[model samples]
Target: MSLTGGSVSVRHPAQHRGRSRLSPQAYLATTGRILRQLLADHRSVAMILVVPSLIITLMYFMFQNAPHRPGAPSPFNNACLIMLGVFPLIVMFLITSITMQRERVSGTLERILTTPLRRLDLLAAYGTAFSIAAAAQATLACVVSYWFLGLYTEGSPVLVFLIAIINAVLGVGLGLLCSAFARTEFQAVQFMPVVIAPQLLLCGIIVPRDLLPDWLQWISNVLPASYALEALQEVGAYPEPTFVAVRDIAVVVGFAVLALCLAAATLRRRTP
Candidate 1:
């Protein structure tokens, strides 16, 4: 009986090893599970999708009523561009961190680790799922701003849409990285100041990077948000894709990939 049991265990592991590569079905299952979880949680849905839209809408109305000098750039376009870069960062960062922390706290992550799931598979699923949500959020925000609030851009709307999606995906990557360090939802939220606020301050939204103190300008050079906002502005200002716009977009996407890789490396099977 002992020999038989030992042989069965060895064969089981060998069979598992033979199938160790990431399975598409498993990846899809994980993605679907996350999407369904988001759907089931009305508050999560509201926070992730609705709240950003509401804020953007309010900003639109406020700027819409403001007076503009003849031939001056419209405040609507300015506000839309800022919101395009910032809102997704805020929403996706909060949602991804909190949701992942919840899974860690609930032992779901640990249980998943005991199964055949690969870390890459899990992270890729998350990245894909969140990117989809980010795309939707970007589309809705852009449509509302352009169609209803009368925001205008000289650049192609397709470029604007693509940049917005990339920015949102960057948020997801940063959120995942931050979540790995946080033990609770509150700690995850606290990361906003550390991971996000600095980027916002130095990303040339308020003061142009060149106008900042030399050291601060140096700091802005390394931050992903700086590139993202720059890409957004470039696209808005240019009618077609420019070399600078493409370079900035590439940088932002690179940062997203790096952060996600780091997140996968830091992910723990058990809560510490």
Candidate 2:
């Protein structure tokens, strides 16, 4: 097009030309960072990957073959798999404050903020890394729980994958929310025993809500992880179809957005 001064104005293609979108690349890079960090901390890596498996295996041997078998054919196996739903989130919670907050303390956060990259992008990358870390542990546990221990999933493996992803994302969201306000990594780690262990006890993972006291049933219903664990057990082992599935998906999504917003607000507070 010709302008008023007899100058030509050219329009660039809206299609991004040769440039590719960044989500996949960013996610890959983020995954790489997570692996590197995990590798750097050998003991921590052992705790995340090995401990969960050991505990899971111990559960399989002890619970699956117990004298008082569950109502379902694969009661013990189902319970072990249910346990996997809780670990990813707990591990992510323990690590988020350690890694992301440490960046803030070390001035790296300020440097990143000065770049063209978005605050949300940084949040996402870290969150993705944590989610993947949790997912890895969960998947490894599922393999043993299902194939070796005779855990049954009436639903498809694909469905289990979806549920696990949802659980990981929800965990990352909660972890990020905690990270945003936690003053130090020690405090973050300290908070976990209080924050996560109760969920395990109250959430449908360890025990069925119907069997719990009336007051406690309401408590578990309000917890996003509780719904997720129920959904996973349904799609993975037990295969129950109910409103809890849809409700869990909604709760997980809501918590994710809340966590992201909290992280952003915290970052903004730290900004000039």
Candidate 3:
């Protein structure tokens, strides 16, 4: 309310609202702001940079003493390769979901949406920032796994890194989409089991997806993580990027794009 003489005046919340266009200036500003926030949070930085390597280190010790048969690969190394992809995806998903939820709960997202800023710009800015974090996380993890843990792959490490980065961005997209349905940070956390658990169980990591029932195979076919794991497996089995590996990577990138677009479509100006 504004005082004019002895009277009070009120304005409608939507009075000044208009269709916000995408602006490079606004997008860069938002991206820079979020990047600064991410850097300032030491815990998040550690989680993104340190936790994956630590987990790999622990796995190394856990399987160091296991008996190995002649002419066989280390079980620990095999598991590490799988986890190299899984860890970044899960970690990125958790961080992105909770962080976005916090913005809504704290009214930051609401206030921003009220401005002349397009939803796509906001979501794209968020994607770019988290992707940078994901790249750093994947790089550190790959270094620890390949250099320190002796994790071996038949294919080039560069291809593995490429797949890892794509999976991390996939997580970011899904997390952004899921956050739209959550009312609180806790609710966002709850979505992990709902969104990720099923994929883990059926992503051909535990059991070969093709060996499972027809219905189960069909389900696995639809999950993006299944494609990610398949791509990693192809890399492990081949010395170069094969046609199948390239196809899987493309599928994952498509899914991530779809998820981000849907999230933008569902974005709300305020929490209800």
| Top-TM-score candidate index | 1
All candidates' TM-scores? Answer: 0.93, 0.77, 0.91
Ten-residue stretch with the least lDDT total in model 3? 11-20
Please estimate how well model 1 matches the true structure, expressed as its whole-model Cα lDDT. Answer: 0.86
Q: Where does candidate 1 have its weakest 10-residue lDDT segment?
A: 1-10
What TM-score quantifies how close candidate 1 is to the native fold? 0.93
lDDT of model 2 at position 41: 87
Q: Please identify which of the two predictions, 1 or 2, would achieve the higher lDDT against the true structure.
A: 1
List candidate 2 stretches off by more than 4 Å. 1-35, 69-71, 205-208, 211-216, 236-243, 268-272
Clashes of 1: 0
Model 3 / residue 16 / CA error / Å: 10
Q: How many angstroms is residue 119 displaced in model 2 relative to the true structure, after the best TM-score fit? A: 1.6
Counted clashes in each candidate structure: 0, 0, 0
Deviation of model 3 at 170, angstroms? 0.9
Q: What's the lDDT for all of these models?
A: 0.86, 0.68, 0.89
Question: What is the C-alpha lDDT profile of model 3 across 78-188, one tens digit per residue?
Answer: 888789889878998999999998898899998888777778789999999999999998899999999988998999999889888888888999899999999988998
